[model samples]
Target: MNPLEAQLDYAFADTLPDIGHTLDVAPGVRWLRMGLPFALNHINLWLLKDSIDTPDGVQKGWTIIDCGIANEATRSAWENIFATQLEGLPVLRVLVTHCHPDHIGSADWICQRWQAPLWMSTGEYFSARMMSAGLPGADGSAMLPHFEMHGMRDPEIIAKVSQRKSYYPDMVPAVPHAYHRLADGQRLRIGTHEWRVITGFGHAPEHVALYCADLEVLIAGDMVLPRISTNVSVFAIEPESNPVQQYLDSLEKYRNLPINTLVLPSHGKPFRGLHTRIEQLNTHHQDRLAEVVTACATPRSASDIVPIMFPRALDAHQMTFALGEALAHLHKLWFDGVLTRRLDADKIYRFQTHSAY
Candidate 1:
């Protein structure tokens, strides 16, 4: 664990659920891990023991939270989970936290397999559909142009990114044609407890985190992670967005949660330092923003800021997010009047300190 991670208390410090299995993390909640074919190798999913009233009588089952990507390995893992782990109860509902491929990729498949309804925030649901369909602005095609405008001019990198046009669609081939919407502050009864929806922004469109006061547990989704800082990027669809500001503002929403809330994040171990982790995240961003401001003392493009923020070799996939995140910080500084942006002679956007400009 890193120094910041050591500050929080991990609920299961010595335990991890195997790929197709689960470990009970809270009352009626089981933790499951799935493999991702990226540098970030795993995504945590949850299974909630649940029941609901139906036309005939009370139906007993489970509710799945966050599906793995749609790939043969992931699908095979789900099949193993279904055969051995579910205890023969049906999956009554599929709830996704956001539109990200790892969270919603296999949603349609799971919902279809069990004939369960899909649930998500309106913003996430529609965004998933648009991206899955490879629509104009949401598809990978727009990434190259957007990054180029922010000054990503590497021919080799651009060539690699251009071939990823079907990246999102390939992982998330479809979304359920319909969905049940989850809204901020809405209460949902899953099993023996009620969870209140806490919508967060800047990570993804309307990401929903759930808090169950009764259980004193918060399903933090990507809002408050224990280990790595959540990626808060300015994607192509929202070019001028100041996601860094929006993400910082959204952290305030969790301040009122109990200090010892057991946070079940979408990544990392289950932890018990809600406020501490939030503080760490805030300080992390503040420090990053300070670095960005210092670097902008001279003119800098998003590409120029990428190495300063992420000082390592990046594959094409990581480069896309790196450039987007670099732009996000610049946009935040520009919005706060800490820097000024101008189009240079090369038609690339650059940011500089106001005095320098």
Candidate 2:
């Protein structure tokens, strides 16, 4: 097998073995798999059943864990599934895991249908709104000049910034005018279940993962996926920031969670062993950091170093992201004082050790 495929297989072996096993997660939680043919391929959404009393002795309402993508087909899929499976229950609340398009795309639609209030972490909610509106983030955009000072040039680099400046709009759909802000350690009661909001970062701004201790379940979102590593790329908008470092740091925070707790992730089947996956992800980034350090022994630009890390040919679309992700790692090393930069005679900036710049 090819090295990449083998690495991916080894990383995902345990999770794949029991994927087809039918397991009852809990009385209230139902797992639904949604297909997306994009690079990541799929996303998972959960339906939390809440039994309540009305004029009838008992009725069921639902709290949707995350709204899937906003496309017409995705909406149709959600509609078909809900109609067939949910027995016409109303969605009482729409809880988002993060601001990513795939997760939040249909949020506005779902909220409009059920008149449900949207709930998300305050930072994620505000950032999602800003992203959907095409407004650049302060910290996200602060590092651009640093890239320019490196080998990246004007007009070309400026165009890259302009393109990146619009990424939020490209990915996230516009949310409704109303949403309830959630905070870390906050408790939310829906029907008979009480869900605690656990906020995570580095994957997305203010990512919220829901944990119900009574059920011993965690809606991990993208913060912890079963198969692939979540992309933590540095963008032109966040030129000098080290998203890789941030992502690794964030992974450590989740390592102390209950190891055997069932994790229902956004991209893969529900499973146990959260701490093992967290450790694997942490080690992956640490290895990548080491690779970047080795790559810097000879002065290199972020663009030049991307191929060394990826070691594969990428199309224009892939190239854009590949460059950004490569720069993310380089910036982490640069921030750690392990790397420095110098402007060449041709105006191309190159990076070396701390003494070089």
Clash statistics: count for each candidate: 0, 2
Model 1 clash pairs are none
**Candidate 1 residue-wise lDDT, 63-155, digit = tens:** 999998999999999999999899999999999999999999999999999999999999999999999999999899888888998998899
212 Cα displacement, candidate 2 (Å): 2.0
Model 2 lDDT, residue 131, Cα = 70
The per-model lDDT (C-alpha) reads 0.93, 0.71
Q: How accurate is candidate 1 locally (lDDT)?
A: 0.93
Off by over 4 Å in 2: 1-24, 51-59, 136-171, 342-349, 355-357
TM-score of each model, paired residue for residue: 0.98, 0.82
Mark the 10 consecutive residues where model 2 has the least summed lDDT.
Answer: 15-24
lDDT of 2 by residue, 178-258 (tens): 789888889988678798888876677788888888877788898877666777776544455677877777776666667
